[model samples]
Structure formats: structure tokens, C-alpha cells
Target: MKLKKRIFTILALIAVAIGVGSVCNTPNTAQAKGVPTVFPKNMRGTWYQYYTDGVEKDLSKVKITKTTYILGEYTPKVIHKYIPHDKPDFERADWIFIPGYQKQRGITWLNVKQWNEPAGIGIPDTGDDGEDGGWGENGGEFFNVSKLKGHQVLSIANTIDGTSIHNTSHWYRSVKLAKKLNKRHYKGFLY
Candidate 1:
């Protein structure tokens, strides 16, 4: 009798442990195979550019499709005209788009330029500063880029302050695409 009772107790404990482990290991349904589903489809549109010091520039178009974002030039002039006088002039190059991940913002992007490569580009979401709570610093402001309608402000992150710090360098909004341009413009940046 004693042997049978001991075996029963051990079996019960093992079953309980397996149950708890399975519950803990369950995957989050909100994310698909680890990729988030919150990205907006209509993120394609023209957005105004602004600098960290509150300097605003001409409107630039942003074309976002299923997998990428193609950014247009802020001005028509050559790269040298726009860069600071002290900066070196590189060859005139066409725009290149690459996929990027912002763990802090929780939104992946097809980027024309590397995040923070240009002084005033990148998305900045809203929330407190730090990792102790609430998406830490970048977790809370996961804006639905696809849902951004025309004329609404899109806030950009300020890289100079620090990745842990959330600062606003630019605010942009969706505007009507020019008649000459088509939805194919969202495919990639044209020279």
C-alpha cells in the first residue's frame, strides 16, 4: 500500500509541473510568428520634415507598401547643397531602402536611410522615459502608421538626446500625393 501511494503522489506532482510549464510557454497570439501586426497599411503619403531645433523644411513624400517605405528627397538640389559646409561630398546616389527594427518603438520599418543617420529622421512614439515601466522608453508609443490620415501630425524621435531618452525633433503629416506620381511610387525611391 505504501509503495502505491508514493507512486501516485509523484505522478500527481509531475502532471502539475507539466501543466504549469505549458501555460508559461504559450506563445502570444497578438504577434504572428514573433512579428507584430499593428503596422498600418495606409502609411503612404506626403509628410513635412522638421529638424531637432524646430526648423521645418519642405514637404517630402513617404510611400509605404506591404513591406517597405520609400522616402523622397526634402529638396531637389544635389546632396552637397543640403549637407553642412564642413561635411564631405559623396557621389550622387539613388535612395536605398532597407528593413529596420526599433525594439524600443516595437515597429519594424523599410528605411531609406539608417535610423539616426540623418539628423532629424525616425519615428518617435509617446510615453515616459526609461525601462523601469510602460514599454520602458520606446514601448508605449507604438503608433499605427497605416492609420495615419491626411493632415495629422506624425512625431519623430530625436537621436541626439539618447536612445533611452524620447525627444521630438520633427513632426510630419500626410498630404495628398501629387498627380504626376502614382501608387507605384511606394515601390521604391526614384532618382
Candidate 2:
């Protein structure tokens, strides 16, 4: 009995050691703590995006500035799941994100949208009528235009390739190759 007890203890110790020995370190994603007042300098220019771009669709014609990320007249919905509109109602929408950046588990690619793209900002409606009329999509309809996947999160890499801002996404890519590229490392995309 004493021998069996000793063997069990030894096995438990070995299991614990092995469990603590292997740790998977993946490269990543991050969101902002507070609302960023303005855009950064690194991503402050017009970039002709390819299919490999992040969430926003300036339709290859993406313009970035200190305060806004302006999209072109034609933005398709396939690349960005939360666009919410069949067709752009106006020429350009200078949107901003109020919910901050997002990248949860069970999925790859860090993306943000209004009141959740499956999930996003949970800002409850004060009393403005939109699609769901609450913290749902179009939460910014008659309220604020910047809280959706307008891709302000997408334009982020262009803003600070380093750490110019706090809220950020790792989905940014190179439009030149029309292939795919990442300026920021993605640690959140765990497959």
C-alpha cells in the first residue's frame, strides 16, 4: 500500500510539472482603454487598398487623417460583415468608434462594429430611434456616426504601426501586393 501511494504521488508530481512546462505564447491583438481623440500620424494618408485590407472599404481608395477615416462611394459588404447597409446612402461617412476595439476568442481577425458585430460596443440607447433602437447596429444612425465597423479599427495600423494609440486591431494588410500582409502582429487569432 505504501508503495502504491508513493507511485501515485510521483505520477501526480510529474503531471503537474508537465502541465506547467508547456505554455503557448501567441503573437496578437489589443483594444483601447479610453476614447482616442484623434488619429495618429503613421496611418495618416490616402492608401489604395487591395482585397487584402482590413474592415473598412474605401474601395481601394482609403484616406486617413488626424481626425477621420473617409471611405469612397463604393464599399462592399463581404469583406466587412457588419457594414449594415445594402448600399451606402451618401458619398462618404467619416465614422469613429465609441465602443473601443475588440477581439474575443473563438474567432480570428480582430474587428469592431456598432453595439457588437455578433458583439461590439454595448452603449445602451438614451432614446434615439435606430434599427434595433438600442445598442444594436445603426446605434449610430441618428445618434453618432462613428461607433460601427466603419473600419476606424481598420485604419488603425496606418495610424500607429508601433504604439501611437491604445485601441487597435491586427487585421491591417498591404494593398500593394493584393496578396495579404500584416503590419502588426496578431496574438489574438488562436486557431
Candidate 3:
């Protein structure tokens, strides 16, 4: 009698698990690969550019609400300057990465689509120098931000290059150490 009851309980648990999976209507092995429309809390900050020489430049006074891109939404007419050729189809972007990107290159992938709930449910302070926690912009007039490094910002945009044929990228960071690092390099030259 005891053995029969244990077998029935185990089977019942398995059935419930399968039932829940079906109700969710998502494959058990499903993984989200798209970025969320909302900007993550970690990317907020006034990032100062870190040049190839590792020098921190003047802080950007530009006020921008952090956000992500939904490539299919905007048309060429809207974001014409940002696009390279202004082609009709802009749904897919082309870039190739080596297989096993994280394992081989140690690249951290920020993978998600939409917040589990909407933004502002539970918030934390990132101290982005008055760029307080809020929803990102609907339509941006200028540049588009690509990658971030916690307190730092990394961007590869046509707007930054400005009429140059070649595209360029840069890295910026919010180093809270001092106003300007390497002060000894130049007495009156720094900051």
C-alpha cells in the first residue's frame, strides 16, 4: 500500500509540471535573445569618454534618457540621419560573431525582451547625476547608444562620426575616483 501511494504521488507531480508548462505555452527550452525596449538600470550614468590613450575627457552635459532599439518600428524618414543607406527594409541588422562568444571571448550577453513587469515596479538608485530613473525616450533626435560598461558608455554611431564615410566607435566611463585622473601628466592641462 505504501509503495503504491509513493508511485502515484511521483506521477502526479510530473503531470502537474507538464500541465504548467503547457499553460505557459512556451517551450521548456525557450530562451529570449532580444533586448528589452526599456533601458536597464545598470546603463544609467553621465559617462565621460575614455580615449584610446586612456584619458578621461570632459563630461557630456547632454540629457538623454537611456533606452533600447526596436529596429522594425522606425522608418527611414524618421531616423534617416542615423541610417547608412536609408533602405526600405531595416528590420534586420547584420553583424557576425564567432561561435561560443561568451566561452571563448568572455563576452557578457544582456539577453531579454520587455521587463518581467513594466518599468518602475521596483527601482534602485544609480546616481546618474540627476538623470533620475524613468522610462526611456520614444523618439530620439540625435545619437543612438549601443553598449554600456556599468558606469561607462560605449557607442558606435554615425551621428558621432558626422558626414564621415567610415563608421567609428568610442568608449566612455564614469570613473568616480577623481575629477581628472593622471593629474601629474599636466599641471594646468587636466580637467
Tell me the tens digit of each residue's lDDT in model 1 across 25-115: 8877744345332234444344544222235434555444443444573322211212322222233332222222353444333212322
lDDT of 2 by residue, 1-191 (tens): 99999999999999987777653333234332353444445545655444434674332555556655555554321222234444333332323343333323422122223323222333333555433322333222111112122332243321111222233332232454322433433342221
TM-score of each: 0.41, 0.30, 0.29
Clashing pairs in 1: 40-146
User: Which regions in candidate 1 have their CA more than 4 angstroms from the true location?
Assistant: 30-39, 45-57, 73-151, 161-191
Model 3 TM-score is 0.29
Worst 10 residues of 3 by lDDT: 95-104
- Look at candidate 3 and tell me the lDDT of residue 31: 46
Ranking by TM-score: 1, 2, 3
Off by over 4 Å in 2: 1-33, 52-59, 73-97, 103-175, 179-191
Per TM-score, the best of the predicted structures is: 1
Whole-model lDDT per candidate: 0.36, 0.37, 0.31
Shift of residue 183 alpha carbon in model 3, Å? 13
Candidate 3: which pairs clash? none
